[model samples]
Target: MDPLHDLTSHDLRVRHAMEYEYRRGTNPSVAAININQAYPKAVSERTCQRWWKRWQEEGVDVEDKERPGFQSKVDNEELRDLIEMNPRFSSEEIGEILGVDSSTIRRHLKAIGKKYVSSVWVPHDLTPQQKAKRVNTCKDLLSLQDSDPFIRWMVTGDEKLIYYVNDSKKSEWRSPGQRPVGRPRPDFRQQKVMLSVWWDKSGIIHWELLEVGATISAEVYCQQLTRLREKLKENRKSLVNHWGVNFHQDNAPSHTAKMTQNLLKDFGWKIIPHPPYSPDIAPSDYYLFRSMQHFLDGKKFKNREEVEVAVKEFFGLKEKNWFAEGIEKLPNKWREVIELDGDYIIN
Candidate 1:
């Protein structure tokens, strides 16, 4: 064998080099020795001999042989129909139904432009009749606004429960691989307060903490409406005289009770026609309460008094324009409800 040998490994380039050496009159042992000298990681003499024989017989190719396996059963039409029937199905669940691997199902899902996502939360599942009612009512309100602009006269109110502690359970910035921080467990028996508030475009008309242990029944609601009327007369006397109170509230049991309806007539306040199951369009639920929830995101209160103070402060901190904007959005929301053909608008 020649002392000056080159390495020829089990690779296309190495095999080609060996072939070149053999064709140039170098012996096989000399070619192998030369290749091993040059490349410490070169294949053994036996591997070179085998590849060299193959090159002579079938030519040189480095790629592996073709692989074989079972074909997929996830057809485009079937997968699309499955997703249309149930958008909430998981990859694993779909795999089980279709007799395929979850990974394969995921691939097909992406190919068909399908994705798993959280469903939006709507306040109510309205019936077709209720939806038609919403459309008709919103159309009526929009028509009225064109001539009267009664949106400015609207005084909407609602009640919400405020707990002693507000924990958003939001994530925080942390080092990689560390466990996420947990929120402190609030006392199961912690104190809570019910806030009943009324407001118009200009600002808050009246808000009160319901007497301890007193839920708002029809009688209590009527009394609150009377107080709201007095507050309106004081703060917005001229507007009230002009519009005579376009009161807007949800169809709660107490609110829709015959006694509550009769009391509004006695107080001479005009009740706005609010369609049932339409809290998404109400200014109190969609606008004011949402803003308040953001303001009270992580606050903690020891008692109802502190919660009241915070609530009052939140109302006071807002400019008159803030209230006006909230009220003005009502017309747009009404239009949206109509545009959606009576479906609940997700904020």
Candidate 2:
């Protein structure tokens, strides 16, 4: 019997007690004495007498009480499935999928000795370097790991590709049973423009617009450097030499190609490259695209030009600091990301 569920255990014991009492009531004194042989563990005559009187007073529920604690949010089987699915999913993500809170997730995980993973959703457009930069930057920024003393700085940027879907800001997939029938699903594939920018804490941005559906060539890459050169000037004049401003970029062919180096030399720029295969680090990989995607949900455009205009409008509305705030998460997360360096973080 479950010791924690008083009603079930009490009902069982009392039913047995009633049968014993009824048998004793019908038997001769010799048999009655024999029935007295039925006793609780270590119970003598006096203890049995006390127990019998207590049962008489309380009815069949001799040991009835409330259930001991909260019911478990996740059971062993589900926990095992989640651990199998992704050993890295945090308490929060597991809880989200299970419709429980993170504490419950942690409780189950701890009980099973399972580690937690993050549940962050990522868009498909980020490059590997963008991914790493975002994770490491956020980690360092959160942990306040400013090894450079008072004049704190960090660079964050992502190459943005605009599609018709990019205008529809936010869209959610309905549950299987809730999907509409008869009509075909909307088509999302199409040609669109790509734009990229290199930005820093001081609010300067060097941006480029690219023609979509074509491989970016050395000439196009050189054009982007031309834009960067103009943007980096103090009064649209000379370039800063040896003045360290960390340049962040995704691993797009244009960003890493030899063409990029020739231009960087001509107009000096400090570049810090992030590791490949991690998107959780790119600020725009998370921030700009999210904001833009939310804006694009359910909207339709006549053409790619219309889509590009919509994107500019969407980004234009966002105040500059909206992007600036991404840098604030530094310092606190320094140790966590550094310790697990090059790994994806989903916070």
Candidate 3:
């Protein structure tokens, strides 16, 4: 029988198997010519040579190697539909739905110009009216700042919990491939003190570490205001004399209670209107406390007195400009909140 007639009679799989056997004994050129003799659509001699080289390098398998590319399980349209169903679904969750790994989901999502980030934490899910109130308040404050040294006249205060264990101990030296030594987990039951403070653009006017087991109530808050009044007389007499006072505080129940409002009225101080759930606009929260928290990082306190001493030292070390800057940040933040349409001003 003619070799070309026999080649065309059988399939390529049988011929390829014969080629491998031929390559084991004869050269690739001989195998190529032999494969062509029997096959109708003959593979080139170069193709046979390439297959022989691959077999030598990567086992005796004749199948083609897997090529490199994105190789995603879910296509663009499928992913778009999945995201449209729920934009907030995590990559892991989406991966489960699409039968792919989270990393694959992330890669595909990125290819389609999608990203994942943390949701900003805010005190409340603001209503449309509440958002409008924030915008109006910010615009009013900005207007006030343009005409007056509003920051200097402002008396802002807030309470913060200073923990005994503030150290993050986030790093430790370890030999390569060895587990890093970690600090002890923070004790939730550790002793902590609440530091209630009042300040202006000048600096800290007054601060008190609340007594153990004593939380601030309307009565306690009222008494603190009375103390704050005395402190203003002593430390900020000039400011008080010139601008009276513009008290700025969150709408805590204790702060907005009838007694608190009456106390401000009686003292002849003006209560600056603060929007509800708007701590991002508060100087104490967005600026002062942020700085204090940074300073307190990696610090461990033994007792309340140590914490107090540290707190006082931290306050004393700050320059007058630092306090001024903290208050100065407020107007910008207010404007940002307005620009964001009452959303929290996240850094």
Candidate 4:
């Protein structure tokens, strides 16, 4: 027959020629080279070797065969479009739309660089003005740190809800073929207490566990500040008398209330500017509370007294350097916030 011109005919002709060469004991490399010299598009030596191995093991049939339940070609563009439209679509859902098996869809999705992950939780959806304010505030703080290193004189504090029972699920070592150990589901409405804590570069300055059914009003917050001032006089007298205190706290209703502001002015402490909805930049949120949460995990507390003891123990175990390390991270965090254009520092 005249040498085939169209692609399919040419492909079959080349395969038949390869079979002929194989039967005649021609080497795969030599056959591939010879075929390329005679054909339009070249086939690789690896392809020739693969066909030879298949012929020896499974018996050769050059004609394309339909797989049992798999498709030979998937419209990758359509698949990409579907994923771009709604990334939450599962493999099965994509498969249904693409008329393929879920396994096939999964393989294709991976090939196209798609991944499924849980969304990161942020404190708030920041508007453009909020993001700009975060960036500008961080810049101003960085400039202030450059002029005078006031981090050592800074006193930062925040309040957190401490649960009576903290349940954490952790991984464990197990024998091969053994199922993982299961843990009971956590209760959503477990009893909890409010813990207000203050710290500086040195260590814990003051802390309190509030009574049940009590909240920190502006008056109450001022009382706490007053107590904190006395604690500073006792624990950090030099900071109070000489270097002075740079107070840091969130803009909660109580902390920013008129009475609270007046009290802070009366004490003559400089208040650090904290951007709204920016827990990521707060030392207590990103550092102190993060470590405290880890310590509290898997622990069971009977009452406010037990929780208070645990909180004290947690602070007692931490070294002075550890507290300083957290305080020192402030500058780097400010730079990072600026670098990210006010995005929350997830790390």
Regions of model 2 farther than 4 Å from truth: 1-145, 149-155, 166-189, 202-204, 234-244, 330-335, 339-342
The positional error of residue 324 in candidate 3, measured at the CA in angstroms, is 0.7
Model 4 pairs whose backbones collide: none
Between prediction 1 and prediction 2, the one with superior lDDT is 1
CA error at residue 31 for candidate 4, angstroms: 38
Provide the lowest-lDDT 10-residue window in model 1.
1-10
User: Which one wins on TM-score?
Assistant: 4
The digit string of per-residue lDDT tens for model 1 on 194-231 reads 68999887888899987544567889888888888788
Q: Who is ahead in lDDT, 2 or 3?
A: 3
TM per candidate comes to: 0.61, 0.50, 0.61, 0.62
| RMSD (CA, Å), each prediction | 19.4, 17.5, 18.6, 15.9
* Deviation from truth (RMSD, Å), model 4: 15.9
| Per-residue lDDT of model 3, residues 225-281, tens digit only | 999999999998887787789898987677888888899899999888898767677
Better of 3 and 4 by lDDT: 4
